[model samples]
Target chain A: MSKIGALIFGFNEYSLEIANNIGHKFGEIEIFSMSGAKEALEKEFAYPINRFDLSEDWGDLNERFDMEKSTAFCTLDDTAENIFLTISLRSSFKNLIIIAIAQNKESADKLSLAGANKVIPLVQTTSAMIADMLDKPVITEVLHNILYEKSSLKIAQIRVDKDDYFDGKYPTDIEWSREHGVIVLSVMHEDMSSEFIYSSKAKHHAIKNGDIFVVVGYERDIEEFEKLIGSRCDVSWSHWSR
Target chain B: MFKGWIVDIAYAINVSDSYIQTKRFFYNLLENDSYRFKKYFDMVMMALIFASVFIFIREVKYHVDDSLLFFNNIIISLIFLAEYLLRFWISSSITEVIIEQSEYDLMLSREFRLSKALRKIARQKLEYILSIRAIIDLLAILPFFHQFRLLRIFILFRVFKLFRYARSFQTFVSVLATKKFEFLTLSIFASIVIFVSSVLIYVMEANNPDSPVNTLYDAIYWSIVTISTVGYGDITPITYEGRMVAMIVIIAGIAVLAFTTSLAVSAFTEKLDEIKETKTVDDISKLKKFYIICGYEHISKEVAKQLVKNSNSLIVLDEDPKRVENAKSDGFVALNYDPGNIDSYKRLNIDLQRQVKAILCLRESDVENVYTTLTVRSIHKKIYILSLLMKEEHRNKLLYAGVNEIVYPKELVGMIAREFVGKPVAFEVIHALRSDYTNINIEEIIITPRMLRNAPLVADLHNARYRVILLGVYKKERKRFFFNPIDSTILEEGDYLVVIGNVLFIREFERSLYR
Candidate 1:
């Protein structure tokens, strides 16, 4: 298997947090600070820090890292700089997955347009959601465990390579959660647009090759389902060591 | 002895304690906005004002029965007379003046002269009589003296009494009052144009045999009618000079009309936001229980969406006008207000502890959220407050600021991003569930009395039959949640069942509970 590595840019709280949480998950990790070397030297980060400017050509980066398997993160505090970094990284390496952090909706749109694979808006929508259900401690704990703590539960996306099993089947025809012990959340079509499984568009559409199904379940159950369905999971089934 | 005497005299009556109590009651009903009885009193007074005005207007065009006229002229006016007297009585307390005079006499070590006390009391009553509101009230009762032909003109002032009963009318007046300078300038411009046009038309057209403007008064009327764009057509000019004057007056009229309209529109536009904010506050106060979200960012939008789905009322407040406008466009009751300002909460005018279910401080900064929580806490000590913690270190600070719940959005997002880097599918699932882009929902359904009355065990309900994963049950009495409760656990009232599944299936399961 090819090694999974992450290249995190910007030396800030969000970058450090992502680094600390996913330290042991990836095979290799590197940090690039956009600031001067003096400031980088002053800060003690768990990962070795390197200095990189947004304008620099990425010849060295391409040579040092396997661009296809590596993921780049643009976590700069400045919205314009982050978007510029995303555009630079995307233009240099088409296969390198790029993620970014945005302060608001406008910046999120700009970052996505700049070629970020995923844009995490620094919005309280996710956190403050549990406030209305504060009385339901169990739901809070379940969500807490899923987000912050490592549990046996895992979420994965599997691509349909062999269409024989599901080519003519509709999403609503099968009880994926009951039969396979996996909750099918959404289906990403060939056009890259995804819809919830229960959505009208997803429910009526016939399954085809190159379609991706996002599912959540235990690691063992996902691997079993992957083998039975003749599909390859994007995330490996290896146990999370954290 | 002096204090008892002062209390009696303060009410301007040497009656018993019940008299004082009755006066105090009437005072609350008449003037206290927060008093419950004031609403009913305002409603009655508003109805009377409308009725009296309608009757007076109807009498001009339609014949009213003699008895009805007598009832309206006497009975209604008598009611207004009683109201006027009560207002005059409550406007100033003679007892307070007497007490003040006695205190002053004692301070100076001099005798309390009866004439001095009488003069002070008379001055207080005179101030109330001279006040504009009091004068309107007096005019409202003038039709009672129907025999006095000159005083009958004051009967129309009954409409002015409506201003006191309808609060919105007062707001409108106050908003217009702010543009006093512009209106003054416009009125002055209009008057100069009217005066010149009226004199010119009178001089030019009055001598013409066929001109309708036979008198200076007719010319003045024509000038006013033309300038107002009404053009009554009853008055017209025949001579060429009069026609030229007419053209000039017409052009000047358009300018005056346009100027007045623009001035009014601009004035209202400036005050429109304030009026809307006040209306939103009023609407929130009417709600039995609603949430107050003190920020209109993305998170607040999401919260408001979910709250609307749950049938929970909420008002979104933000300091940024753009965000507030965005929230309004999104169909939420939103107001532009700084959450940290105590005046914002005071403007809501709701019994916070009773009417507000919770107050969410979702500002982008920890300091702002803390300040918001502090402001809310200062207003109501026990109202539930939830704050979004921007930094982990500020969690304790938020709690200290009287926040009942603290949520850290960045920390959650950071953890999710890490998971996404390692296991992309997991990230997708979690993201889909949290967002509205998917049909999946994690909902909490409270066990109804019927379900509890059935006395079914946890295993008997068959969550798998409904195809929903029951995560746990929150026991209300214990204030605890039992995760994946044992099959033998008996269902109880007030227990919230936390389940995750398709929204349709959740609804079906909830409906089945009643069966």
Candidate 2:
């Protein structure tokens, strides 16, 4: 069995999501929160946990957790103050990977100065969210597949507007794979539900006005597809709320 | 006659045609004269005639046979009557004595009737001061018997005739006319107090021997003196009823004085405050072609310093007095008030908003900058605005909010730093270009399509007007800059010409291109 340990501190909804996401990545994940991670274990999953107050002594936290065994410590505190805790942990556990959140540029600077392994501003998350929505329904599912099941080819969403020439065509009839070097994985209709267009059920379905075509291609091929779509097309996701 | 003399003076001053003709007539009358003393002599004679009227009034009170006074009065009346007849003869119309000669001519030439002429005469009567004064002078010199000595009190009304000679008196009259409503309110209050006090005194001291309020007339005189707060002490109230009336009068007098004093003080203070406020605004605005920053926030300090370093005039407008004072302490011209207020804007002379080179709104919040941008755009549509946007989502909103440029400070600083770390030398060059301390830089210019005519190539533009090199031209059409354009590359009007040179040469080059 591969022994893997995770340290989660300052856990909120976002931190909990990150914890849940990271749990599936490893064989054994030990979660720790500055508050409430232990209580959360009773609902669905069980892991060895340690709870510590943020205001408590750093020395007591060092004595409690075995730093060498912990593979990664993630801080989800949306402030520069989290970097101090990260620094304290980094001093005890020299090889542990530390990732922390920053509220803004100024806080990001302080976090970087405090020697966290990685510091990401909250705005960076928004940027990532924007980049993801630019790829939409399938891209999200593909990301989930890659992170959980180690998939190579991934699904991505592409918008079809009035200006696009591919309107009113069936996906199966179009030679997207041969001509454009991309595969049509699925199609999302105007009602915002996805159908696997390459499957038998969706073979007869014609492309409508507000259809989103799900494509699976290499990164370079995706780049080429984006260029073909051109910069004039508005790539915002109307369904997702930030 | 006095009207003719005034017209003569006016002609001597070259103000009217009749005056000019009369002046010529007078010049002919006093020809071969080394001294032009007739004008001065006439004025002195008029003064003496007025003085003698007053003297005659005082003398007639003592004696019945005032021979010298009567003779003097007759001579003055004859001179005045002759003068009046001469003025009437020289003029073209009967209405000339009352209406202005120019107005009379205008009306008569248009064939106005007697009724129309009378209306015109009445309208001009108030304007014809010389004619009115001459009429008063005629009344003063007219002879009267001992019983009509009371009529001689009309001679005191002649004192008003001196006003025509006095400039200060004319000014006082004009001011009083303008402030007629204020004076009327004051006088009404005074009259009410006088009427009430007089009636009370008459009722109270009807039988008191020591009291000066023995009659209604005496009571009126006493009331006048008391309410004026003069307290002449020529009259006193001795009875209980009299004392009660006196007490009420004294109290009312105090109230009236206080009320009038407060009114004067408030008006004076308000005027003084307005002047002071305007002076402060003027001091800030006198900084010619200054940048007006409409808010005080974190970015303002750096912006102010940067502008100051470039020797550019800066006027900071902030509602917080302390912030304004702080900016002033930091060597910036600052106005400690809202720039958006109409009165404040007026005081700053910002209605002529073209004088301001640029407006900057860097308030902590995007909403505040949005409002400031709107106000700036309303005042001057072309003024360049650099505003700070708090959120990335608000960037589009602020762009449509009328700001020429929106800066997300966090993102900008981060990007700059990132560039600095990635390409140090390139970052240094960009920094030097942006700095006030450095000489070389890239400049952005807007060219319209019309300016593309004749194809003045960019290569020839180098050292054409100033010793500046045209590095590139950014065409909005192409959405890219053409680096180092040759003679073959055609120059277009709406192209932004990026030039590299010293600051002085760059400025001269810009001026030449624009000119």
Candidate 3:
């Protein structure tokens, strides 16, 4: 099994925040800065820092860490620099997971095109949505518990190993959240493309082998769901160790 | 027995139903501009005022026809007299006044005094007659008497009656009325200058035979003409002292002219923004419901854009002029008013119970957001306020300040990042659903009273025929969101169905359910 590690680019506020918040979850973390090591020393940044040049081939990265097992965060304050870093990292490692911070929708689109697997737009669109949905107090409590507070609400990806059960089952065939004890959010195809289960397009697609079901539920419920579906859990968060 | 009978008659007249109805009808016709019937009444009144003034002007220069004279003198006068009496009658209720007087006498264990009640009623009517509007109305009707030469002079006051009909004229008067202090000061200064200059010119030029300033009247007229810059040139002072006096008066005239123009211009400039703001408020009030955004920042912009997409009217308010301008350029109704100011809320003229759906305090700082929330809450006890909490520590303070909802952007972003690191696909699905990057959206449709009456099951909504997914049902009465509610669960009024699908399909599903 590959060890879980993180490669964080840029020594800025956003990068520092992500490192400080989710840094310990990964087994190892390496922070890269465009500026020299002296500035990092002056600030006394907690994470181990490395100086990197944009034009250089990442020869030291491959030798130091397993690229497939590691996740890279491109969080440089400058949009162009972040995009270029994402492109370089993507070109070097095909299996590496890259998440980039975008200041706006335009940059977010550009970052995605530049091979970032996920783009976190720095705007408050998500928060605004959650705020609008706060009329239902239970949802707010659930979301808050899942986010800032520790709770049993685990979001996991279960790989479909047994093909016969899901061979011809559409996403809407069974009640997943009620009878199954899990809210199946989306289904990821073998090709890495995913669609939200509730979407109209998702209604046409059938679940099959090698498909991954992303679900949100309690710890015991998720485990039970995994056993019932006869699928191995590829990844799970929220109930993991600090 | 006779006295008792007389008292009964008076009581009957006081409570007469037809009398109250007639009075109410006239009150609505004259005072309620929004009443449909008042529009017609106003038009007729305007036509009469114009016709009477026209005839009065015609009579000044030429002979008037006898029939037109009779119409203006009799028909219009009778209408005016009726209007005056109606206005007086409505100004105070005699029945209420008499009832109160009799009640007071009974409380004191004394006989009811008719003369005392009459005195009180007369004083109230006198107060109404002394008012400026009533005085104008009296002058307008007096010209119809035509027999009193002095009352005929009041015919000019008929023109002032036009002020009552035209709303724009009232606005203009109000705008000038705000500069009462400045105008008062300016007029005093001008008067002093005119007085001194006229006296000086008279003393210097009256001794000469060539001078037209033989009396104080001529001097005053000359000074006024010079000071106003009319330069009639009918009077000239041949002496050097008089010419010097002319020079001083002319310079003073120019000074007074500049000061007056600047004062008027400043007053208009100050009132122009207020007028525009009032118009915006009026327009918003006309909407059945609307939202007020306290700041025009990125979060607010996003919320506003979404609200606009959902076809909800909103007004963006920002103290920052630049942000306000940006919002305006982006095709939003934006006002440069500070959210932390109580006067701004007062200016909105929000009816505490309706029209305003919510106020979103999306300012960048916690202090500003909290202050805005407090200001809004202080004035509107029940107005829904949603504030953006910049820091987690300020959450309690915001809630304490009476924010109905607090959205912490940092925590939300942090959560997204954590989820992105662990389950990228789930992150993608959620991000796509929220950003409208994909055509999918998680929308909440309220099960209105129309739908609850039918008592549809959740299973019906979950059917594939709707072409949407029923994620959950938010039971409003219970204040809980039941995840994937049981198929047998009956939908209740105010319960919100959280569904995800293409926007068009979701709308279709809502319409079908509502139907």
Candidate 4:
């Protein structure tokens, strides 16, 4: 059995971050940048990056990777391109695992229909959420929890239901820290826009019903948070429920 | 008999209360019955009840043998009467003893223990006698009085008592008890639909001379027959409006009937699923601290077998159903589901992610393992991930994917072969130490804050008369393992104490330090 290499399609902030976060785990790392030249990505990542058009046949992919062993990650900036990449790769490599990213539910459905094994929805505040996780002791602690999994504390996404208490309040008003046993990661607006609570724009955003908050806490503490805010909080990303 | 009553009062006073042998036997027979002697007792009682019922049913017939019927009736009546008296005797309360003690012996005042005890006994008797089982028992004997036709119904009630003896019938009754709400809902909806349709048909066709529903009652019967799809052809709608109502009724009947069928199917499936889950619950406990091996490949199997041998807890997930069933049959906890599926991962209760010791990703396809590692890392970044490297390049990929260790089988075997040729004695010794389960073992124990709070320091550990040799102390802060540390080396919380010793000594030593 050949060791699986990573096939990252498209070049974007998410693509770059994902490449960096997951680049070391693969035997061979290749980036298919639609807009950038090979020089930039190779210099940046110290790995091979090729300029390619997704519309073209990826016949060379079979030679580069054992089609039976490689995983194709479609992290193209545009949802449609990712869906396109998913379909193209799936058509070529019938046995390979194809993962694609979607910006919303509709694209997720499209990517899934296009034969992506997993479609992770990229929320608006993902970068900011990552930044929040990188904060001084919090990042180390979060990393510790993720790496060692030695604590019961978990990250949960909760929707802000209709509540009288938080209707007129700002995001900064709620003490979602040690006192409440929860650290608010980000807040998703009714328009599907999301921002980390620490961001300048989010700090001023007024709390409203139907907004979703991503928080990190223990199960009981999360339940307690639900009780206090009267919000419908979920312990997992429900899109994965299917 | 009077002396016996007096003795009962004396004994009750002597012991405060008594669980007499007869009382216990009868109590168990009625209340705490199992598939034992009580089962046989029930079978016998059921047979007798059914026989008496059979005789009564025959006597109701025109040409029954009168003389034999009378003899059998008298015999069955005597047995039922005796059983009934025995049940009554067992139900007697110690309340009377307390009452007598309070009222006459202790000379307690009104509204004291005496009156309360008497009231309790009276209430117990009232409750017992009025209970359905007790009523059925009483009715079974009353059938000997064939004078009244109404008593014949009670004789039929005796057959209902088979529910107590037959397991399948008992389950039927139990399922009905749980599903009464659904059945009730269906019945109520049916009734409403039937009533409305009947009224509409009756009102619309009342003036039509050709209509079979000349009367309101006939329209109701016609409506029910149409809705049930059991049309007897005796009644038919004549007017166009009446025919439309009948068509609507038929269509609505199918829809409502399908809904009822769906409810039954869902309920039955839910019950089966509950039973299956509960059986698994008994096979394994809620994972507090355990290892998760993602695939049951040969490599992962070897890993899991060792974990089990060492008494470590684990759950194995394999995409292959046959492999899953195979592992389960071998007395290991296994689940058949694609580990790459996030929902299956969620089912793993990854929220309590810390309980996971480590994830051994040994999928035949390294790509799947990489995805699994990425997913597991995304959800629980702190969990240790060990993957078997299928290709040389996958090492870096797996590491980038957040795999803690990538074991290359060929490389490991090659290294071991080289060691066997160059340093045979050392290899043998190392292998022997680990393989000799009954004698030697290597183990790691972490130093917790609780240990620092109560137990002796690291220096004291060296002199604690331990037969085990201290191999190293892993410092969490510095992320370094100091081998052969000096006695004065200060110990910190979260230090791993790596040691080699006799298996028994290691076990005892671990127990002492952890305790």
Which of the numbered candidates is closest to the native, going by highest DockQ? 1
Candidate 1 residues A1-242, lDDT tens each?
44557888988778878877777667677888877754645456568788899889988777778888788888998998999999999898877888788877689889989888888876534634554454334565555555544666556678877678875998878877557877676787877676767667887889888788876667787898888775755553221111
| Residue pairs with backbone overlap in model 2 | B1-B83, B1-B84, B11-B19, B447-B493, B447-B494, B448-B493, B448-B494
DockQ list for all candidates: 0.25, 0.02, 0.23, 0.01
Compose the digit string of candidate 1's lDDT tens values, residues B246-265: 89989999999998888778
Give the least accurate 10-residue stretch of model 3 chain A, judged by summed lDDT. Answer: A233-242
Which 10-residue window of candidate 3 chain B scores lowest in summed lDDT?
A: B1-10
Candidate 2 C-alpha error for residue A137, in Å:
42
Q: TM-score of the second chain in each model?
A: 0.76, 0.43, 0.66, 0.48
Which lDDT tens digits does candidate 2 get at residues A1-242?
32334566654544544555554444555555665635766456555566765465556545545444443444555464487677666666665555556765577778767655555565533323322322222333333342222445333456665425655667766766546666554555666555544444456777655666655455566557656653212222123211
Give the per-residue lDDT digits (tens) of candidate 3, residues B160-265.
8878888778878898899999899989988998999889989998888988899999999998999999989999787899999999889999998998889888
Q: Can you rank all candidates by TM-score, best first? A: 1, 3, 2, 4
Whose TM-score is greatest here?
1
Looking only at chain B, model 1 earns a TM-score of 0.76
lDDT of 4 by residue, A83-193 (tens): 887888888777776767776557878999998765655431121222222221233233334222345655455777655767688776665653576656567666655
Worst 10 residues of 4 chain A by lDDT: A127-136
Chain A TM-score for candidate 4 is: 0.52
Task: Compute the TM-score of each model's chain A versus the native chain A and list the values.
Answer: 0.73, 0.47, 0.73, 0.52
Q: Report lDDT (Cα) of residue B5, candidate 3.
A: 51
